[model samples]
Target: MYAYYGKEKIRMQPLHLLMERGHSCKLADIVKKCLRLDLLEKVTMKKNSALMMVVLLLMAVVLTGCASDDNQAATRTITDMAGNTVEIPASPQKIATMTGPSYEMVFMLGGKDKIGLVRSDHATGYPLALLTNSDLPNYPTIKGVGPQTPVNAEQFLDAGVDLVLYYNNAAELEKFKMAGIPAVVVNTTTTVPTTTEEYFEQSSANLKLLSEILGGEAVERYEKWYAYLTKNVELIAERTKDIKEEDRPVVYWGNTWGTNILSSYSRGTRDFEMELCGGTLVAPQEGGQFPEINKEQLLEWNPDIIFVDNHGNAPELVIEDMYSNKNWESLSAVQNKQLYRIPSGVFFMDKGSTNTLVLLWTAKVLHPDLFADIDMIKELQYYYSTFYDYDLSEEEAQKILEGWVDAENLVR
Candidate 1:
């Protein structure tokens, strides 16, 4: 018999040849020969079983390949602002922040629950922990955080913190990295912002970075806040931009605690606010360094309008000084009763809480005829509810315009 072997024909003896003529034949030839029906069925069944096993194994391999992506994304790596590469979970479950400004970012992002330690001993938590949010006042304050202070590694470990946020704290960031934890830097200005525009830029950057990490209502809230600021600021800018340089009001900003000069944000962000509101800074053309000027210098610059920061009740004495002092009586601001105190709520509005409110306030005060339609209280109500997630009643907003004292009882 001729059997096809690949493309060639080979002569082979049938299995029956051994039975019929007792001829020698190889096992291959025997298997190919028509011997018995039952034997043939058994051989075919064995080959089919082996083929089925191979098909099953291939299917499993393909399924595993499909699920590989999900398995790999269990963790991720990111580079922080300080250029430190860090490995973090795909979603952070535990978090800690070192500085107050960073904490402020976290708190606004609704990541307060993710925090490991409650806070560092120093708790400014700017624009974040408002007096309205009752929980912030009572959050546990971690002590011993300052210049030359080492991070408490055990706190992170014990609290199961997976991520830490610092403001340019390289040493502490390294400590977290060495301890098998990831720390990211959120750059905030320790120095004053030279201009209001720069201040907004930095603030928006911080907010956006935090939103990307937290991944929730943060982005929406931040966008709304940003839009709100831009709309009002642009309107103010348009009104003020074309004003003649000579016509711009000369303004002075004082940061005095009682009669004492604690510090001043001259030519700083707040000073820029005066300019954008159609006024000239008494001390302009400076950087983020809040330069100190004496009473004599202030007299030399006899500003048309004066704004005293409400920091440590400076407004109380500043207002009194303007009202009673003989030296101040010579100034136009004091004589015309333009000596006003900057407003505050959770924190000072002019300080850091929300400058949009103050910007609007300043613009209206500087050019009342141009900004007649603006309602400061309504804006504050929107800002508090929209940005901070706290409700600001009409009364509360009005109180915020005056000073922080009236808004002390506000709650989230």
Candidate 2:
């Protein structure tokens, strides 16, 4: 005999085992035998012993059905950026972002409550996190997990992580697979885009992939963000397309890491942003993405405008040093007071979602007369309110544009 527990089949044993070998017996015979032995009356004198047996059997079947349901966890399959097919939880409760920027991306996608771990370097100090979430300081962080560092799967497992977001790291992906953890690569492109079309395509792909993973409101937000990005990119491109080559200013975008001020992005999105905003990149494309040029080379280039990337050091301090340094005295940017600091929020304006804002800001800076109607403060406020769901006052928006950090909320 068999009993069906939902979709599962449970084999039922014969009741004749309760009787002598080779003897036939019905359910009533077993109940009668139990009642006669006083087994059924031990707890209470039940007039319906057969009914009690039927009730107990029904409870057992229900419990077995529940047990079967517990064994089947809900999941969904997705192909990551690196072409790896991964099965992840339908709604991950504990998400660990191995990449620093991805932490902000996930937070922006309305998955802040699902975030269980974040990169330690970008955990507490980000202006976006401070402005948006008051509880950001208490979020858990893991150190030494990024593109250069090897992934430690055990640490993530110990933290009860249900999903992991990472960049292109095959070894790390394999490690997560071996540990039975679902990892998704979120990189937009494997290589730097050489053209404007390629850049937008890659950027769009990145946002779409993230939205697909974190569905619901994330998909709606992605559409809004991409539309805004497209609008600004087209606006800038249209305005700058007709500008004469001789009229374009030679611009230099440098990063400030420790005492090094000449470390600049030679190509990729930064270069495209500069060119699209009526500025010619002073650094050659062949020099690689992040190359450190010497003082002599910088003097030779003598860019008209200098934009300092506030990476490891404060932008104001780096600009102040450049103004005081004897070697930079002859540079046209310093002499003309054209040195400007790139804006930062959740992430640096040069990268991530803020890149759109940077494009608009850069166009206004390079060609003030042409883009006189562009109000960056209002734009900043709108972006924060629309995407981050946080209202920013004029003062707070100005502070972010000036690259100001809240020291009280900042962790290192």
Deviation in Å, model 2, residue 141 alpha carbon = 1.8
Q: In lDDT terms, which candidate is top?
A: 2
| Steric clash count of candidate 1 | 0
Can you give the lDDT of residue 362 in candidate 1?
89
* Residue 110 lDDT in candidate 2: 78
How do the residues 1-412 of candidate 1 rate in per-residue lDDT, one tens digit apiece? 3334345544433333222221122232343342356544433333565534533543443334435434545456676665667666666756676653466556656666666555532243322244556666555456666434788766666556667777576777777766556677765444455665775775466667767777777667667778877887888989998999888888887776556532566464555667789998777445443556767877888889887776545476768867798877888888898877787745556533376778888888888898999888888877777667788777777667766543222211
TM accuracy, model 2: 0.79
Encode model 2's per-residue lDDT on 1-412: one tens digit a residue.
Answer: 3333345543333332211111122333444454464554443322356546654664444334444333553467899888889887766777887764677677777778888887765665676666787766677888777576887776876677778888777877888777667899885455566677886887777668778888898888888899999999888888999999999999988876755778876666666677889989887565643678888888999999998876755667779998999979999999999999988778666666677888898999999998999999999889888888899999988888888654333332
Which numbered prediction scores highest in TM-score against the true structure? 2
- Pairs that collide in candidate 2 are none
Give each model's whole-structure lDDT.
0.63, 0.73
At residue 299, candidate 2 shows an lDDT of: 93
